[model samples]
Target: MSFMIPSAIKISSQFDAGNIEVLDLTNPQDIQLSIRKDNQSDFFQWFHFRVQGAANQPLTLRVLNAGQAAYVDGWPDYRAVASYDRETWFRVDTAYEADTGELVIQHTPAQNSIYFAYFAPYTWEQHLDLIAQAQQSALCEVHDIGTTLDGYDLNLLKISKPTESEAPAKKQIWVTARQHPGETMAEWCAEGFIARLLDEDDALAQSILEQAEFYVVPNMNPDGSIRGHLRTNACGANLNREWETPTAERSPEVLAVRSLMQQTGVDLFLDLHGDEALPCNFIAGQEGAPHLPDTILAQEDRFKQDLAQINPDFQLERGYPPGKFGPETFTIAAFWVGREFNCPSMTLEMPFKDYDNRPDADFGWSPERSIKLGESMLYPIHQWLQADL
Candidate 1:
């Protein structure tokens, strides 16, 4: 009788935004793993980890608990992303076994050490780098609003052009993203928006700046982001749900941003996000809010139309049904902002799966496309301002 020996391939996930629990590493071909749940919450879907000593070797990794995740529908068409340098992430062959409830990732590593993630992670270091770079521009000012539950800085950027004769106060345009930490594409999009807003040579950006001031919070739940939680902060509180009545201990992140919005008064609001099940880019408007004005509805329609025309990657055909939030609508950021400010508030959702309208087999809905979408937002805002409503 002959017996096979288990190889010495190693796996780990102890770094930033890393979440994985190893089950069996006895065989590289059948390595077993499970995603760790968010702190104090049952939500678990995001996963990031590194594999070592498996270069040029075919391997199969299985997530045993994939069926029980918060969004099981996200698994059907999703492809896992991998990177050797952690800077350039590309999709690999991945499939979900409905019968076994396993998410299987198969790949042959070109390097001894390679990283994999649910999506391309936007790290805290990258966030810091983006803030530092943006602050160097004269049109931008960085502010440290408060500390998170984990003692991380909650940074906000205020961008506007200085003027001596202000005919009327520039409209206060508020943009926030990444309330769900796993939706890193939101921050990537925000970074692109900031970059173009500060660019001195971009005429569209300059025109928008002349009529509106931007208040942006790139990362809303830093604790959840750093802890690798999919939809909550340090205390397992979904920041979006706390907008109705945010507290200091449970959801200070929302309290701080909401308080600031109260002080500045929101004329227009946008909250960026990523939908796991959806396969296209779309906007969820605040039409469900009680007593929503027709003027605000008109503004929302025009903005969506402009965006669709600006980027074909964005479409208006498919999205959440109207009144999807139901009674819980006010708990969401967009609805709350719209109700409180009587302004045009929208939730812009990118996708974890490929954009079905303009699918890219190589890199489905990527950071590059998200950034371009962000840059394209200036046009609609300009159009809204030109309407002078």
Candidate 2:
């Protein structure tokens, strides 16, 4: 009698933003794993990697530290994503066992090589392509701002009126995303923003460029991004928190960008991120910024109104509560910039889960929608700049 032998299963996370610490594995049903903390930091949540050699096997991978993750609420009713070809990602059955603090993933792989992620990954190669696409435009200028701790080039794009013009730009506008490397949607949205800005046919792009210079940093933490860390950089420093006193050794990414912002000076800014617990797209500002004049506050309101008119995805209704009145905490990028520049600044967040208001069963708050939201932002930006100029 001949007996069939199933091959040994192999798992790997040796690529960009990949994170998974396997605990125990026999058959698929009791595969145990834990999310690795970001470098030296205790923060953990994002996970992505590949599984192979076990096809057509029913698997139940359990996250051992589910309750200990940064956002435990993100697991309940949240489905994990899987891919066979890496081009198309679909949700797999997922549930959280609160009593055991386990996030269980149920899947039966159709192919030997299958991948899983907390969400669809937006990779570094794609980011380079985005930068290249922007550079194709004469209005776009690429800047190698600084070096990351891991030695990856920190890039920034500047788009505005041609330098041949006699007068300099009237305003300096800044937009940076992906300070938390796991918030991949932020860069996807930035891609849309870059595309819309470079489109020669877009009147809003042209108008906005005529009035202001844009400094767009698509990926703020390349080290954390490529390492798949949730919130910290190569040495475990949170870039957002380091804004107050960024050092070249620990947070060169922030130090470089902040230095440039100091040189150009910020008239307005937007810091983009993804929120695990929230299922909506919204904006948060530092109302606690010192002596925020009512005029600037009114501008914030008007800009939000314009945003609502422009993009159906954005809402001002649900967001982080205002910080109680106090001295500005420069630890937060938005608060630091709002206080320092006294400009209209905001922290824009997109949900990691499905947008509950307009849910998509097949694909949750997807990369495509995030990109579209980025494109739509041009309207409010153009309108706001027009009024000011």
Candidate 3:
């Protein structure tokens, strides 16, 4: 027998083994792991652990702690990622046993060391690398949108128009991610979008650069992400909720972004995020915004219909309930961006749970799908630019 060490799984640097409370691994066939907060319930979801001395063996992982977690329903149809090299991640079979709140992940390793995560993780180091790449591109401009309270740069990458002649009609399109820092998949999707946009061979990207300017903020809440917080900033503020009347004290991130939108006069805005509870990929728009003209509504409808046609991953059905106008909290996405800018803006939500239409038992809602969805977004957005705004 070949001797192999299985000490390969490493959680994203933001989270620690302290944050991960391993409940039981008595069953070699079913190793159990759990997440932990300092004083909270046993409930956990984000998990990263290593397996040593188990080469060429069929390893089964059972993650216990989903029962009391925030979105327990998500686990039933989820799959986890495993990587022997930490670069190429593939899906493994995961089964959520409802009776005991256990998530069962089964994998046969050819090599001893393998890493696993909820999805292919886009770590902070990778974010820095992305920023470096964007800064080097000839057509790209990179800068700090602002600094988070914890002093992390809210990086903004701008890809300008390739030619001076195309300036007059060129529109500004904004895509931002990680409002909820736990949604690491959003960043991966953003990375894919940015990479595709910068590629010279990309026809859609070429068209977009000629007709529109792209502004991307790949990490909106670096503080929260580094802190391992679920849905809030370093100050415990939910950045998504502070859109309408964002103040510096409560949400400087929103304040900076809103100011930028005002300065640039946004033609399009997409806030990328992952849904903890939802099981589908969909765009939530400002359907009930007060005084939104029929023309704009038609444009929005066309955008959705066109996107659904292009990609099987995105659907118009199974999204949040419509909120009436002037309701500050409920109408955040629809009310503020649409009514204020009079531009097409949307909250594009991916699922923490599996895509109900096409479920993967091994890798539920993986990063590959998220990146593909991001690519699909370009088509619908291009449609919006070509026809409406």
Candidate 4:
């Protein structure tokens, strides 16, 4: 009698920004898996995991609960990202079956281990590294504004070039990203923006720093990010929706940042994000807010036009239609800030999938592109400030 022994294959998701639930791993060709929901919430979609002991072997990963996720439309045209060195992420073969409600990923690992995610993940450790890097520049100041429910620090970066003479007050520019923890592209964009702002040789950056001060929150929901939640913090509160009336227990992140904004007084505000369904980059304004002035509305239009001209990746044609928020307008961060400060407050949304007009087959809507878009934003900002003068 002869007996066949099963091969050893292991899967894990215990690291930072990792979320998955394994069902069956007996057969690498038919591995069964499911995405874990955010803590204390029903929303599930973000997934990151690792496969070990499977070098040069064909494998298939199936998420059985993909259809029940927060955004079903995000699956149809989506391709999952994979990495070997964790530094370079590339797109792999992915398909969605509507009937079975399954998301399938097929790949043959060239090495012994591989990591996969909904998109290229920006880890919590990476966030700390970014903060530390920014603080090394004499132009940047780091502040521990508050703490999350999970006992993590909430950090804010203030960047400006000091002048010896008593010049007129500079414009206060506020930029924040990653209010929804799953949208990792937002933080990536923030990284690029911060890097260019701190560049000593860049003429555009130096010119902007001479006239304006920057207040940036690179990762707004660290607890949710580390916990692998899609849209909420430790206690299941969406920070964006809590801007109108934030509390200490439910959303201390928003409470701390919003209080600081009130104290500092914003001249221009931007909240960065990633849209699950949109395939192109665009901006969504606060047109739904009550009592919006003509001047503020015109300023928003001019800023959009300037950005569209500066960055080819950004467009003006497609986005959330006007009045998309309806009665809940004030609850949103952009809308609340626009109404409160009467400035050009906007949400810059990147796509999870490839940009439809100019898609890259190997790497779709990647971190490099996000970072370039962030660097490109300085041009429009400089133009806006120059026009005012």
Candidate 5:
């Protein structure tokens, strides 16, 4: 009988809530949002905002700058996540008015405080929890290869059978994410991969642990990821670019991960990522890597073709223009291990926007889809790793 109409909060494109100030909230039901462009840089894809005091009202928040945002194309069919406790994020109905360049979101808050993001964020705390949880698994081993400039551990998680045996038949598989810290969906994909690999009912998982060892670095840029940055490390260095020649001063994450990859010898490697421009899920390979062997190229193509058949969400329609090995297109996924190891390595890019071919505004290319992709990868990989294949 008594409903409380709490106040509202403004939104912005900036990360830290302090740098940009709020304008109005009195009209909570009809709120407006704006994006503040980075004056020193041309980046404006990141957004973080808060809504205060709207405890019980169904707030219809509108971001009028959606169409003008740096990657305006990413908003057409998307759902934004919101949380009453910042710990649990669920999607809300969001429609992008293409003609008006507006993003309209509707949500009714249960508490005075609320938080939202492009996806359910896997915060730094969650990363630490993942490390701790994996360490406790009998099939899991934790190795600290090196430390970042910030003194944080450059972590590596090795998962395999626990029995004592000299011949660990487990084929070596490696997965790393967050080379670009702002692409949080990468980590979500990693989460799904690790979860499926650890599932008890998963016979494929059981066989994988017995026949192959998995090395995962779920968060490669913890400092940048935690600092709410779109890309680059704490010192503003992009880790992906530093892979070919990683140094402690600039990029210890790549250094540690690459060192382990060489030691174990990567049979299969997947670098998870999110693309701002591309609206479809696809795989980018090292076909252009100078003198890439015929066998590895075949494996890469086979894997993509198989995944497309398994999941309708993934397609090979659009992706980065293929480039020959050179400084211009040097990426961790393209040139580093693929060239150095001469193995079947790839970069699996999910879209920040929904999978256009089969769009679901309620979910989009979301945490759920990321997880499914992780699961679907196992089948193709298993088939490829077969002795005959």
Candidate 6:
């Protein structure tokens, strides 16, 4: 009698922002796994990996700790994204076992190798390419502030109207994103923002630049980003929590950016992020920061309303409830900058899920939409600052 050996099914996550702790792989029908917690922090939810040798084979991969993830609310109504060619990703069948805290993904790949991720991934190579493209514009000045824990460059970009004088009078507007690394939509949004700001024909962008000098940090945690970790640096420190007491050893990324912020005073600061559970794009203010000014609050309200008019993707209806922050000692970027510098600061959050107000079942919340949102923000930001004028 001749017996055929079952072909081996292979799973790999050994790339940028890749994470999945394999437990049992003997049975494709009952493959078991758990997500690895971010280094030095307790955040875990992001996952991206490739599965091979299982073309046309039915398989079920289970994450044992789905309920214990950083955002359990994200699992429900969330369909995992999968791609064969990497250029386009679509929703795949996923089920969450609430009682067991397990996320079960069932798929049959038509290709030899396919990627599955919580959301579409934004890789380090794409990030560098974005920077290189933006650098070609005469208005941009790229600066490698310092070295990250993993030895990657911490890039910061300054974009403003080209002036003949050594120094031009303009309000210093700071926009930084991707502090958590896993919130990759932040950088994509920044890409749209930078592209529009550097456009020669845009009258609104020109008007914004006339009054503002932009300091933009496209990625704050290259160490965490390149390592495929969800929310921590190489040493397991969350960059957002390090803003208040950043150290050279633990959080050089924050330390370096903060130093540069001090060198150039900030008039308005925008820190972008992504919320796993949310289905809309929204902004969080420094409501709990010390010395609360009525003007800043008014500006926040005005910007929120005005932005909704500009972009239908942005809504104030569904978002994080504010007033959860604290004093100047707080480590968050928006709150810290607001309290220390008396400047209006905000945290813009994009969703991993689709926008409930305007859903796209196929692509869900995507990089293209994120970039459009970023482009929409320039006009409102320019208009809001007019209150000061």
| Alpha-carbon shift of residue 274 in model 6 (angstroms) | 0.6
lDDT score for residue 349 of model 5: 93
Best by lDDT: 4
Instruction: Write the residue-wise lDDT of candidate 5 on 1-389 in tens digits.
Output: 99976343544434432112344456877777655443333445455566667778888877776676667777766777777776556678888898888888899888877776765666777788888987877777888888776677778888877656686456788999988776888988887788788777899788666677889999898776665656667677777878777787877788778887788898788999898767789899886767889988998999898888888888877777767346655556556777777778899999877778887755566777887887888777777767423
Preferred candidate (lDDT higher): 3 or 4: 4
Q: After superposition, how far is residue 112 of candidate 6 from its true place, in Å?
A: 1.4
Task: Score candidate 2 by lDDT.
Answer: 0.87
Alpha-carbon runs more than 4 Å astray in model 5: 1-42, 56-72, 85-111, 162-170, 324-326
Looking at model 6, residue 325 earns an lDDT score of 51
- Candidate 2, residues 1-389, lDDT tens digits: the string is 99986688888899877899988877678999999999889988999989988798988899899899988988877888888987687888889999999999989998999999988888889889888988989989999999998989999999877655677557899999999999989998999998998888988788778788899999999899999998899999988888889999899999998899999999999998998888899888766566788887877878788988888888878887676324436788988888788898888899888888888888888888999999988888888887885
Q: What is the lDDT of residue 340 in candidate 2?
A: 84
For candidate 4, lDDT tens digit of each residue in 236-307? 898899989999989999999999999999999999999999999998987766788888888888888998
TM-score of every candidate relative to the true structure: 0.97, 0.95, 0.84, 0.97, 0.83, 0.94
Q: What local distance difference test score does each model get?
A: 0.93, 0.87, 0.74, 0.93, 0.74, 0.87
How far residue 51's Cα lies from its native spot in candidate 3, in Å, is: 3.5
Question: Regarding TM-score, does 3 or 5 come out ahead?
Answer: 3
Candidate 3 on 1-389: residue-level lDDT in tens? 89975554422233422134555555657666776532222224555545655677777777777677767867765777777876777777888889998778898778766676665666677789989987787778997778888887888898975667634678888888988777878888887788878877888888878889988889888876765555667777777778877788768888898888888877777888887768888877777666778877787778889989998888887887766234564326435777777877778888877788998775678878888877778888778877843
lDDT of 5: 0.74
At residue 121, candidate 4 shows an lDDT of 97
- Local accuracy of candidate 1 as per-residue lDDT tens digits, 259-335: 99999999999999999999999999986567888999999999999999988988999888878988789989999
Candidate closer to the true structure by TM-score (higher is better), 4 or 6: 4
Which residue pairs show backbone clashes in model 4?
none
Score candidate 3 by TM-score against the native. 0.84
For candidate 6, the per-residue lDDT at 289 reads 58
